[model samples]
Every structure is written in C-alpha cells, then in structure tokens.
Target: MEALNLTSSGPTTFILNGIPGLEAAHIWISIPFSVFYIISLLGNFTVLFVVAKEQTLHKPMYLLLCMLALTDIGTSTCIMPKALCMLWFGSKYITVDGCLTQMFFIYMIAIMHSAVLVTMGFDRYVAICDPLRYATILTNARIAKLGLVGLIRAVLLVLPLPLLLRRLPFCANRVIPQTYCEHMALVKMSCGDTIMNRMYGLVLTFVIMGSDLTLIGLFYGLIIRAVLRISSKKAHQKALNTCSAHICVMVITCATSLFPALTNRFGQGIAAHVHTLLANLYLLVPPMLNPIIYGVKTKELRDKVGKYTCRM
Candidate 1:
C-alpha cells in the first residue's frame, strides 16, 4: 500500500523549466509568448473597459462577458508574467508557498472561466429559447447572483488543491518541467503517493468541465431547436449571429484546454516540451482570442469599442 512520506520539513523551493528542451531558444520563444501576453492583457482589459463604460452593454450577456474578461485577465496574469520573467531573466526559483499560491489562482480562474462560459450559455438559452422572459429571468440582480455563485463554486472546488498538495512530501526531483506551476506538475514531483491528488483532479475536471460542457451543449440544442421554429430567414440569421461569438469562445476554450490535457494524461509518446507548450497555449490562447472574437462577431460590442476608441 502506498503511504504518505511524511517528513518534518517539506520542500522549501522548486525550480521551474522554461521549456523542456528549448532552453537555447528561450529568448526566441519569449518573443511570441511576450506578444501573446501583451495582447491578452490589452484585449481582456479593453473588453472589460468597453463593457463597463458602455451603458448599452449593461445587459446580462455583456455582464457575463465582463466576468469572462476578468477571469481571462486573472488567468493570464497568473501564468504569463512569471513565465516571461523565467524566459527573459532566467529567474526560475519559486518557493513552495509561492508555487501553491500560483496553482491556487490558476485553477481558481480556470474554474471561474468555465463557470462564466456556462453562464453565458445560459444567457443564450434564455435569450433564444424564451426571448419574452429573457429580461425578467436574467436581471442585473440575478446576473450578479449568478456571478457570485460562480465565484463561490470555483473557490469551493479549487480550495482543496493547494491544501492537499501542501500535505504531500517531495522526496523526488523538485524541478517542474513547465513554464508555470501546474497542480498536476507539482503532484507529479512529489515522492509521496499522490493517488488522492490525481484522482481528485481527474474527478474535478470531469465533474466541473464535463458538466459545464454538457450544459452548454444542451443549451445550444435547445437554442437550435428554437431557432429552427422561427419562420423568417432574417430572424433565423439574427438568432444564430447572436450566438456566434459565444460559440467561438466556447470552441476555442474547450479545444485549447481539453486536447492538451487529454494528451498529457494518455499520450505516452508525446514530448515533454510539447505538453509544456500546449499547457501554455491552453492558458494563453483563449484570453488572446476572446476579445477579438467578440469584437468581430458582436456588432454591439464592436460599435461600442469603436465609439470608445474614436472618443479617445
């Protein structure tokens, strides 16, 4: 039976890898990564600013967009700056407490991102499936409640991760083979039996992301059915267009997150640096693309951004 390798003193520090096999290219790699980081920061911030400043965007959908933008900013901030510093300055040492804190916020924002996506899906469902009651159902007070519930849910789910990780003993190598401190990466470094940690992570991913994806799919199904019932072609087109931005975000997020994770868990032949790159992309791409997607696909948002920019 596997047992906890308890010790009086736990690991004090961990060294993070910039990229598994790309140390020589860290400077070159930092260029694109830096661009993505800067764009993600500016994009997400712009989305939040536009949504907040524009009174016309005070609806539930835009409010959820604000939540997503905030989550993206939080998620990107947790990963990018540290990774950039590691690449740029060769500062790779992170204390155990700092590692755990980074893990906490990364997982927290990720869960919050999923929750926000689900809420956006729900907003779409209400908007399309029952257009008449959309206003009443997704009121500002109710959206606020939903946002609070999402925050609580994300907090509750991710709360155990760092705590559980703190209990494990690290007798093996303390170097994490990634740019950032991932929960699983930390767990993999522990000499102690980490079945519980691994199982909890797997279960959490399945329960939270699985359920959110299912709910989004179901909502879209209902939405499609509702759209099909519409008689006019223009009305049908309009209904679908409303959902295009959310669908794009949903696809990008799920693809960026799920594929790399599945490959990491199951792909035995995949390169370590490939996993690292994927993990970085999973965190980076959505935040980078989300604002552009919304700006292009969402006319109201585009118009608001245009007006906001023109006034400047």
Candidate 2:
C-alpha cells in the first residue's frame, strides 16, 4: 500500500465503486438494491406505526421491538440511497466530509442496534425470570433512558473517528472500492500513518460489540434456565415462544455483521464482488427481514399487521 502525493490543496472527494470488479452489472444491481430499500422503509415504518397504534404493544418487549425497527431503518437509510445512486446513475464521488458523516451514522446505528438487542435480552429475562417484577423494573422512563444511553455510548465512541480522520493528510488514492463510506475503507486510503486510527477503531468495535454480545448471552442463559425450571411442558413452551422472535432477530443481526467482518479480514480467497455484496446485504437484510420475522412469528403482531394491511 504505497502512499501517493497529495494532488490538491483542499479536501479530496473519493470515487466510490458501486460494485467494484463488477462495473458492467451496476444497472442490474441497482434493481435489487432499489427493491430492498423500498421494502425496508415500508416494512420498518409499518412496524413503528403498528407498535404505536396497538395498545397491546405499549409494553417493554414490544417497545424494544419498536426501537430495533427504528435502528434498522436508520442503519439502512444511511447507506442505501447513496449506493443506489452509484449503481444507477454513476454518482460515485463522495466528499470527505460527506463520507465521514455517512461513516459516523453507519457505525452509530450499528452500535445502537447492538444496544437495542442487549436491552431486548434484558426485557426477555425479566419477563421470564422475574415476571412479577418485569413491569416495575422496565418502565417507559427506563426504556427512554436506555435509548439515551445507547445513543450517547455510540456518539462518544464513534465521534472521534471522523475527527481523527479529518486531521490526517490523505495524500494517497482518493478512490474507495465499495459502495459506502465505511470507517476502515476510508482509513485504508490515507497516506498518513493510521496505526492509532486503526487500533482505536478495532478496540472500540471489540469493546462495544463484545460487551453487548456477552450481556445478551448471559441474559438469554438466565432466561433459558428459568424456562427449563418450569414444571409443566406447556409453561416452558410458552416462555420459549415468547422469546422466539427476538432470538431470530438477534441471530440474523449478528450473523450478517459477523460474516462480512470475518470474511473481509480472513477470507482472502473470497471474491471482492462477493464481499461487496455481503457488505450491501449487511445493511439491507435486517431492515427488510425484521418486520417480516416479527409479523410472522408473533401471533399478536401478525394479527395486527393483517388487519392493518387489509384495512389499508
């Protein structure tokens, strides 16, 4: 990775390849990206509306679902439109400031997603293990506080990245080989020494994502134990059923994120186009699938969705 001399006096604009190593497929590629974006927006918005309108969904569990839906929307929205434009219109140039902003929101939403999932696990644990105290422990105010904490945590952690990047002299290639302005992608283009930048980003990701995963696992472990202790099969099944939708979402979210991160880092034999597709899917799949999963798996949500769709 040889560094090039700075070509201009001002900040540079990087050319984003809509689908690197697959330029000829950009037009056709935009079709699916557009479809996914539309579906994600509609699906997440519907979840928000449904959760808001249905009084039965005002409880902590459903409220957490609502938060997860919102996080999905934010995550997908940050990248999809630019990616669509690049695929369809050849609008691949992104300014440094704009790119940093996109990168910030992208990581911020991802962190919020982990936070929401962890909180959802807590909601489930309380509902199952301490049913008598669930309501008292997770009130509306506490949920709001959780959201605030997630936001603050992400902001505090990710805020330094763009600032640190901005301070670096990017006297190198101004071309990024992906559809979006990811932190690592942009860092790879810099001419200046980025040991600190790289190390901090990796450390932050491990700390936040790692802690969230551990907490989620612990909560689910407790939930599982509590469910198994139930004397009747029916009660055990009922408790597990209550947790199924959330478990599905957590699996999907973690799988999508982990696959790309691991593949990019270690799977050198994988095709670049495949990596790009996975990167795109990381943003698209969750938003599009989450509402569908909840709508199909949860009877109450399914009934409400069916009624709402029929009414509309």
Best by lDDT: 1
Off by over 4 Å in 2: 1-8
Alpha-carbon lDDT of model 1: 0.89
1-312: candidate 2 lDDT, tens digit per residue: 555433357455888986778999899988888888899889889989998999988877788888888998999899988988888889999987788899999998899889999998998899899989987999988998998999899898889998888767675568888999887777777878899898888888779878999999999999988887889999988999889988999899888998988787678899988988999899999889998888888898889889999997
lDDT (Cα, tens digit) per residue for candidate 1, span 180-244:
89988888877777999999999998898889999999999999999999999999999999999
Using Cα atoms with residue i matched to residue i, what is each candidate's TM-score against the true structure? 0.96, 0.95
In angstroms, the error of model 2 at 273 is: 1.6
